[model samples]
Target: MNAHDPIRRCILLGERAPRESLIRLALSPDGAVFPDVRAKAPGRGAWIGVTRAELESAIAKGKLKAALARAFKTGPIAIPDDLPDMIAAALERAVLDRLGLEARTGNLLTGAEKIEAAARSGKLHLLLHAADAGTDGNRKLDQAWRVGKDEEGSDLRGLALPVPRTILAVALGRQNVVHIGLTERDAARRVSETLTRWLHFIGSHPALPTCETVSQGASALQIIPTGAGNSVADDDTCEELE
Candidate 1:
């Protein structure tokens, strides 16, 4: 964890974790619960580090309601039936917004040729592919990234997002955004932070095979490539680029 990331305890799990890694649920004056993804909302808030499935289970079992009551010290906290969907939507919006911001700043590069050149020249800080991207194209770019990072024999590869090319293109205001590369370190880190949090909340699935968000550091960011059904640990400590 970064030294600056404040630690907060999850009301549902009672486990302490970095605030950035957790989602904050703000309590309204009318006793309603809503997701505060950016954590910018004012007033009393409770943090949760559990995944959507876990959260739904807690809600069904009345565990989340009891925890909220204890945390807020209030009565009749109204838990919405669609709280899980709301949280997922909020997280997805956050990720898309981050990408759009980066695109506007000219930190993102598109087109297979451009990304391949950046990767081969070691200028790419992060690489991403749309969910429906072709396997051959993905492998080609993955090879380029490895060559640039001097890890030709290793398993370092670009992340595959859950969304398709159409969604990514719309978010970045581009055409056919099948692949994307971040040229700046800070831009990559910022995108990765939001992406990681979103991914962690949704939890890994077979659709997101061999994918992960970038890690913050002086060197190139590292993402652990895994096969389908493999899982990445839910932690903020991004692995070094060595």
Candidate 2:
């Protein structure tokens, strides 16, 4: 409920946001930082990050404008489409960071190694897998479940500094990380939210696919067209972003 969440602020400030300590608001969600959620323009700033459904609900009920009005310390800044992409991106980065760390520290176990290691370990505080993994691998996990980035660090392996997509971006001295496990401290909690993002699209499977870009499953990944329609919510050509 806290409006000034750092990640949400990052969404507001986009690239213009300072990465370090506390800073003031940026232009808007539809600014250069991201081309989505164009409604938050030219007006003052307010932060709100709970859940996409919740935000959408607020919009449906008109509570969104009321809250923004009070928070902006004035009348509400015009909130365009309640595009939660900024929040979604933040969550996605969180997942990538976790996957990256598991790759870096040797904790992330992909392929058969993930299942073999988990089986050998017995009961786990948390379980994880991509939403898109095959049914064959899915059957292998005793209690394998989908994990979100928010759940990465705490319930699963303890990681420090969260997951970094760079680890995944670079070849493991060879190929980028398709799968990994986090067994190190500091890195565990950092990657929870990130993992949650992955679980959103890829379901939780016991073993990581032998390859990246796993096959899709029953998960509600494309619940809506991302980015494509945000700028044009009410048939308006997203003036804020342009």
Q: Relative to the true structure, how large is the alpha-carbon lDDT of every model?
A: 0.77, 0.36
Error of 2 at 85 (Å): 3.3
- Could you give candidate 2's per-residue lDDT for residues 1-242 as a string of tens digits? 01131222222212221111111122354332222222234544444333456556776787755554444444225554524555455445555654555656765555546544653464222334443444455444422422322232222222122233344445234243333444443344344433433343232322222112222232222122333322221211112223
lDDT for 91 in candidate 1 is 95
**Reference-based TM-score of each model:** 0.84, 0.45
Question: Candidate 1: minimum summed lDDT over ten consecutive residues — where?
Answer: 216-225
**Candidate 1: deviation at residue 217, Å?**
16
Q: Which candidate should be chosen as best, given TM-score against the real structure?
A: 1
Tell how far residue 44 is off in model 1, in angstroms: 1.0
Q: Write the per-residue lDDT of candidate 1 for residues 1-242, one digit (tens) a residue.
A: 44444556677766655566778898888999999989877766787888888899999999999888877777689999999999999999999999999999999999999999999998888888999999999999999988988889977788899999999999999999999999888888788777777777787532211223333221111222233232322332211111
